[model samples]
Target chain A: MTDISRDVDQQKYNQALEKFVSSVNGNTAFDGDFQGNIKPYQINQRMLALNVLRNNFPTVEKILGESVFTSLAQVYGKYYPSTWWDVNIFGDQFAEFLASQINSAKADAYNWALIAEIAQLEYAFIDRYYYPGHDSTPEVLIEFSHFDYEAQQLIKENHPNLVITYNCLDRFQSTANGEKFHSSHWSVDSSQKSKLKIFSASVFRQNFQVVSAFSCSTANL
Target chain B: MSSIDSFAGKQCSLGVEYMGAGLGLRFPHIYEILSQKPKINWLEIHICNFINGGLNQQLLYELSEHYPLSFHGVSLNLGGPEPIDVAYLQRLKQLTNELQPKLVSEHACFTSFDGRSYHDLLPVPYTQKSVEHFCRRIEQVQETIGRPILIENLSRYVQYSENEFSEAEFLSQLCQRTGCGLLLDLTNAYVNDKNLGISIDAFIDALPHQFIKEIHLAGFSTHDEWLIDTHSAEIPQEIWNLLELYLDRYHNVSVLIERDNNIPSFQELYNECCHAQSILDKYPS
Candidate 1:
């Protein structure tokens, strides 16, 4: 730790930093005309959050372009406006947001489902970027063994055009101690330029099996 | 002794050290910076971004090996009428211990209120009681981090009607009381000058030269009649002139160029640093 220096009155430095501030707020012993409006701060925050979200989900922004993306970003902010300073929690629901846009015929340039898929992929990569990698991945077709019945049901019921829950992410998400990342659906074989195998329920079953394999790595994209 | 009780004689302020002109290390510019290894004086980061361990943190450690680094934070909320989070400061302290940045800083303004983070620096009302308010928080931060911090004045939309002292006087008292230093952000001064009619030159003159440990030079955007310190565009000539005014007396203060929005290409930003570097080279220790 850097060297700390404190030489203020004890009567003033009342509580711990947070507790002290609260007491100060209550005491009202200090009188000043510091009337702060929260609106300007809110406006700036919306802009900052959008810029950061654009960085976090580049593919979504690039596909939607500036005008479309800004519109989507405003809508995204309205729904999930919690500060994205922590990158992990910022875009957790972005894919869902994109998918909802399609339902409303808002983004009709291309396949919105495909765009949602891209968002999911990008978010997973970002999550992977934060968690980092400790395991080495081979550049071959690898089997993922962590899928439960619901995951298999989603793939099997959706048929050939199903939203494949990129299983590689489930096996590799190593959450940090006490970090609050709730979603565990994105992983990358981060060691080398490795092939990311996306397994669908139609392709895999009770046993580890693959009927059709697709290279869905962000590298290929 | 109660944790709230001041750490008896545990305070130690770091001495003045300058590393020419520097740039805020943004995530988008990191990969290119790693590969290209551009010529730059130093790097300042938001501190919160790298506190959580990840590839960015790992890369930051690698970058620290090659450049002089400083930690600039936004969450301290030193001027807010709320409790400062102890856990946040401890995490910050952990990173400070691991990286050992030469200079560590937070704005003199509050960032978060109640539980919601405003996510932008709000102005602190300059009054005698608020001076004590600012001092106690700065002392708490200094006490927690075990280092004297440089308090940067913020850019805001409004000035208080009950401002007892000018920004310079308020900051001077805080420095005298708590042993803290000032990070004179010239662009913020320029904004407050234009928007609030406070004379920038007068503010600079009133501040003790010994207390100004660092200089922050950046660009601001115009909002109707007000000048917003948006750090988005290239460094304006007016802000550069302010740096000249500040550099006239204060030397060996580290200069940093900040860009938090509409960040341009690395070459463009790095070239802007050359401009500040040119000015720094004009003045010598």
Candidate 2:
């Protein structure tokens, strides 16, 4: 084909693909988007993004049931569609997304700020998990007996990759951890901060494992 | 199944056996694959999973020691309009240099567009312009990696309203232009056959036999009333039938039983691989 015809053909493909991308992404609809059932394609993208969310934000998935988690993932994905090549890093903005949703009354399923904080902790967990710490597991483990007040600062200085995330340790645990806290107890709204004395929740690796081990500041206090 | 004998020595691939059946290495089976080390032909790796230094990366290195690994990537987005992602390519090049995998493959679909990345594989249009565009990208990839890579066909929900070439014709031209091989996915062809009226038989028959280097057999699930390529459940009878059809024409090519989600015990997936191996045993090698 000649240059002129090729250029026209290229322009046509670019236009078609741009509309297809926007439509599948739920941004805008054009006449006859692509050809066939695009709903499944859209659904599949959400499912793929959910797998990434489940990996990065396990605490969020656990606190929210499977159905709720799936819905949250789809909605979160539409707002902040991933721009990272690695799906493992897809949910970097999710903790903030959850906080935004709850603050805006878009999601009132859980009234407490703990859910969002757990998401914050989970994000840190994934970051530390992906951090190029060591090819092999580190020989020494972090001991809890070392620090009283200045531990967070000291640990940050020592391990630059270490992440100390979130406060209000107990409420997040009560909702997310093994023993189910009563639903009535899960009403610690962020607005009522002084009513409940929130404890600090710092995540650290007990061993070299990627899964984060949680600790509270009550003992430190 | 002509040998890549010319390309193998310098690359350290050294004539991949194309053992009738292989398994996609997923995280669930890592420990079992490490400890139990079940009998299998070869293993395919998701290139993105091992890029950053993580437990999965460590595990992949360990697994590479045991089996001949193939790097199959979803994030390259070669079919998309974005200029080649230099950082991603560099990481892939580093990983390829480190692992010395038997084969490296990416999809013929777009996973990113308009400055945003997508996790799922989206379809590429079958126009001559698209063919030329992807060829330039594929050639760039080959020049960067110093080896030809196979492009896998995607199981898509929609087809473009207008096409200058059929899927088969497009793939054939793509390989001829860029010197890449085809990762013929029978499961995807089955999905397209059932969801759209595209024929797997015609797709296979039309392709030049030499271009097919690997075959993928994956499970599809019906979600939201449409047959989606979930790779999360059991492979249906129709996909198995398609595999038999594929094996009849082709021999000594790598075949992988791909299961990403709803992963079964390693033994169960291995059993499915063995089932594929049994069918291969029936045919002449």
Candidate 3:
């Protein structure tokens, strides 16, 4: 084929594919839409996206309930369309989407913050589960004591890849306290601040299992 | 030489294999497979699952040590209009070089078009134009990977009006043009037959028999009058019958039982493999 014919063919394919993508994304006005099953196909596409979201963010799904979760997932599907071939990576930006949604909602500020933290935690787990480190050495076996005190401190300061931490301790503790108070009383005052306890936890994959270690603020170095 | 040797020699001559029967390596059954060292002939794995370097990659390396592996991928959208994703192909090539799988395969359908990807196997119109475009992409992929890849048939819910060729005719012409092999998915064919009123026999008969290098057997579910290829449940009896009919003609093909969701115990999947083996055992290669 001549270069001119090749360009024409390429143009035709691009046009057809654009129509198909639009139709699949629920723009049913495209000429390439499935003859009689466009509506059903659209529904199936949404369900596929929702299923991926639920799988990736089980905690968020449970907290938001199915109805609300499905509504949010549909909106997310439309706003943040899948750009990768692997659906596993399709929900990479979902935590940010949840944060935006929570900010827009007219819910209790404390409860919504807790929900957003849960989304962050769940998305982190999903990302860690799939993209764990390439090193063959076990993370738990790494000895910080082997190096001198100054070297160890430098390593701890510079080596960001050594740990996966979610700095949501305050939110986690507050949510627990709020749930405890809500079990006995109908409502808890959002203005009342609980005792602040700062801590950190490192979640890592060891022996094909997710393991974590927590250190409280009072622990001696 | 033993019968197995003869079969292997013949298959190797064709640049493929007759890896008698196998099962998809699911994470749930990874421990059992690694520890027990089951008597299965080979294993098929979704290549995308192990693309990222992690515990999964380590496990895959170990599994390759025990059993011959075949890499099946879901992300290579060969039928799409855009130039195939070069980055994906590079990663795939890296994995292929590491595993040195007995066979590598992807679907004949497209999963992405333009900049957006559906993440599901979407059907391509079976027109002459589509066939040419799809074959050109397949040729490009083969050139990039430095090896021929098998293309599997998809179980589709809709067909385009502009389609000028049957699925089999398109596949046969594709193989003729690009020298690619076929991964005849019996469950997909059965589902498409029931859902679209296409004749399964005609579909199978349309393909060039020698190009069929692999076979996939899986289960489907019925949802709102549509037979969905969920690969969740056990291989139904009708699909088994279809397998028997397929084996009658093609004896030198690797068969794999795939279960992705609602996975059963390892014993149950092993029994399914044994059942497929019994059918393959019925006909001498």
Each model's lDDT: 0.65, 0.72, 0.72
Candidate 1 residue-wise lDDT, B1-285, digit = tens: 542232222223447687888988986787677677888888998887776554446667778878878999887778776667777788788778878898998888776655545566766557666787888888898888888988887776655665678888888777777778889988888887787777888988898677777888778777556677788888888888878877777687878888877888988888878888889889877
Sort by TM-score, best first: what order? 3, 2, 1
Q: What lDDT score is found at residue B33 in candidate 1?
A: 79
**Interface quality of candidate 3 as DockQ:** 0.26
Tell me model 1's lDDT, rounded to 2 decimals. Answer: 0.65
For residues B106-178, could you state the per-residue lDDT of candidate 3 as single tens digits? 9988887768777778787786778888888887878887788999999887777657799999998788777
TM-score of 1: 0.70
True contacts kept of 2: 0.63
lDDT of 3 at B125: 76
Q: DockQ of every model listed? A: 0.16, 0.35, 0.26
User: Per-candidate TM-score, first chain only?
Assistant: 0.45, 0.54, 0.60
Per-residue alpha-carbon lDDT of model 2 for B1-285, expressed as tens digits? 333443233234223446668899887677667777788888988988787765556667778889889999988888887788888798788888888888999998888888788777888789888898898998888889878898888898888776778889898777766778889898888888888888878888998667678899989888656677889887778888877777777787778899987989888899889988898888887
Regarding lDDT, does 1 or 2 come out ahead? Answer: 2
Ranking by lDDT: 3, 2, 1
lDDT of each residue in A81-167, candidate 3, tens digit only: 888776775677776777676557545432555555555545544554456354543332111111122222322343323343333
Task: Write down the TM-score of model 2's second chain.
Answer: 0.92
**Which lDDT value does model 1 have at A101?**
74
